[model samples]
Target: MRRAISVGRDQLMSVGVCFGKFTKSGKFKLHITALDYLAQYAKFKLWIKPNGEMQFLYGNHIAKAHVGRISEDVPEHQGIVIFSMADVPLGFGVTARSTVDIRKLQPTDIVVFHQADVGEYLREQDTLF
Candidate 1:
C-alpha cells in the first residue's frame, strides 16, 4: 500500500517561482514566465510576420523586412515584446532602432535582438521540471 502526498499553496509559495533576478551588475534578467506576464503590459511591441515568428521561435533576431507593425514610440535599445500578427505572445527582445531611426534602416537590418522565446519552455523542459 502507498500513500499519496499533497502540498498546499503555502508550501508552493515557500519554494517560490523564479520569475527573474538581478545580476551582479544590477541588471534585471527576466525568466520566460516573467516575460509572459509582462508582455500584456509592455509599452513597446513588435508584431511580426509568419516568417519572422518562425525564425524568432528558433532563437533568431528579427529583421526589418519581417516586421508587420511596430508600436508608435519604441526607443532604441528598449526591451519590447514580440508577437505574431495574430496576437500571440512569442518572445521578447531589445529594439535595434528607435521609431525614428528604424525609418532609415535597410530591409535586412536587424530590428530586434532575441532575448527569450516561448520555445524555451519545451527546449528546457527537463531542467524546468
Candidate 2:
C-alpha cells in the first residue's frame, strides 16, 4: 500500500507480503530487494567500499571512511539510500549526520545509516518464501 504511495505506482499483484514500517519522512522502509528498487528514483544515496560490504550485510554500521559517495544535498534527518560500490542499494535508513559532518570525520569513525537489527526479519522472509 505504501510503496504505491511513495513511488506512485499501485499495480501490485502479489498475494502476500512482508513489509516493514515507514520512516518519519513518510518513506516506506524495507530491506533486501526493495533497496534495489528504490535506488531507481531515490535522490539521496550513499555507497560503501567492498571492505564494508560484509559487515553491512551482517547488519553493522557503515563508518565514514568506508563510505564512498553520498548525496551532498541530503540533510541529517532525511532518508538515504545505502548502495554498494557496484551501485546496488543495500538498505534504507535516516541519516544521523549531514554530508558536511560526514566529510570531517575520521576513517574509523561511525558516519550513519544504522542498519536495522532485522535478523529475525530476514529469517522470516526466508521461511515465508
Candidate 3:
C-alpha cells in the first residue's frame, strides 16, 4: 500500500529510516534520494550528525531548514522521506543524512516521517520469499 505525507508549508531536507525500539542504536538513518521535485535525477550519499543535523560527504551542498513535525505510520522495515522547500536539488542515490531521538516514540506513534523517499521505496518493493 502507498501512503502520502503532507509536508505543509515547510520544506524537508532529508528522509529518515527510523528503527524505533527494534535496534539498540536508538537512531534513524536519514537518506537523500535522486529524484527532484520536478523528477530530475542525480546521485550521492550524505551523512547525518548525532543531533539530527545534516551534512554532505562528497560534494558542494546547501544547508537544511528546520521544519516542524508531521505524523504518519510506517510498517515493519519501512521508512519516510523529507523534501527541501528551498529547491536545493539533491544528488542521486540514498544517503544517511542524520539521526533522531526515538525515546518517546511509541509503536503506534509515527516515529519516522512517513513520506520520505526511502519510505516510499520500501512500500513499493515486495519481499521475495
Query: Which ranges in model 1 have alpha carbons more than 4 Å from their true place?
Result: 1-17, 22-27
Query: lDDT per residue, candidate 3, 19-73, as tens digits?
Result: 2122367664333333343233222222223222232222222222222232233
Runs of candidate 3 exceeding 4 Å displacement: 1-33, 37-53, 56-67, 85-129
Please list the C-alpha lDDT of all candidates, in the order they appear: 0.85, 0.70, 0.31
C-alpha displacement of 108 in model 2, angstroms?
2.1
TM-score for each predicted model, relative to the true structure: 0.81, 0.67, 0.22
Better of 2 and 3 by TM-score: 2
Model 3: residue 33 alpha-carbon error in angstroms: 6.6
Q: Quote model 3's TM-score.
A: 0.22
Point to the candidate with the largest TM-score: 1
Clash number for every model?
0, 0, 12
True-structure Cα RMSD, model 3: 17.2
